[model samples]
Target: MRNVILYVNLTLDGHLAGPAGELDWMLFDPEMNIALSGEMRSRVDTILTGRAFHHGIEENFRAQASDPASPAELVDFATWMISTPQVVFSRSLAEVAAPHRLAGEDLAAEVAALKALPGKDMVLFGGVSIVQQFVRAGLVDEYWIKLYPTAIGAGQPLFTEQRTRLELVDSKAWASGILTLRYRPAR
Candidate 1:
């Protein structure tokens, strides 16, 4: 059985995005990138993100495709982004551009079923709102957070309405002041 992990970067204030839906505050250090690379390469295999993040990917692809010489670099990133199968959950979105399969069903049940597939762990890179759903469902087995040094006092929050406890597994300080944390549900 595969585990579901949330390997996403967040701010000290626990907001993955700013009020304007920007990640301008995340310092994006090499250590964090290295960890992400490790996760992509060896750790969790699948990449899961919400509709908002999917929109971001689409916009990035459009921007990258505009430059003719960029496809080489872009195709590489795209290959990595879609390297493992991806599941995007959206009620409003009918179709995605490429390499993304629709969940096409209930969120919790779909993800739970997906976890039963052959894999190490399913990486959940959420849009906070989507993460809340996973958390509420009690389906996430592990939590991996790249906590940035800076904090935005007010913005979107990482966790949501259904309050739950998480027990700290371990915490490491990256070279660039980001904190790599692992947590399991308190229960």
Candidate 2:
């Protein structure tokens, strides 16, 4: 079965997006970006995201990703996101782009069906609200957190106030001083 992995960058203080949704503290070194992009390309067959982060990721490709490597990787990531099957969770908009909405109904069952198919891993980006829904539903399989060296008191948190415990499967420290912590929801 395809696994659901969250490849996100967070501060040492554990915030995904800072107050006002600022992500300036995110680590974006070319080396690590390429490495993570390669890894993500190899793993994800589909991406599910919240609309909020989708715009930011899209904007990066337009303005900040000027470097050849960065833009190239961004192109690949964008292409993958656009071309590959995508299911977006939105409560407001009607429809936007490819693959259409995977909103409503039993998302966990839908995710499981996608996983059961022969493919790479299924990934969820942005949309922490939806992510929390999945996490609370006991659907998430793995969490790959790239902990950057920074601290923010207020911002978007990773996990919501869940009643269950999650098991830490593994973790590794990168040369950039970022820690990649791997977590699996306890069964």
Candidate with best lDDT: 1
Model 2 stretches astray by more than 4 angstroms = 57-71
**Candidate achieving the largest TM-score:** 1
Candidate 1 ranges with C-alpha deviation above 4 Å: 58-78
Inter-residue clash pairs, candidate 2: none
lDDT of 1 at 128: 74
For candidate 2, the TM-score is 0.81
lDDT of 2 by residue, 59-122 (tens): 5544544446655667666555556666676777677665545455567767777778898887
Tens-place lDDT per residue, model 1, 1-187, is: 8888877788988887788777888785754665566555577667787888777666675566565776464555554665456788888888876567777668877976887788777788777778877887887888888898988877777777778799999898888998889998998
Residue 166, candidate 2: C-alpha displacement in angstroms = 3.7
Alpha carbon lDDT at 1, candidate 2: 78
What's model 2's overall lDDT? 0.72
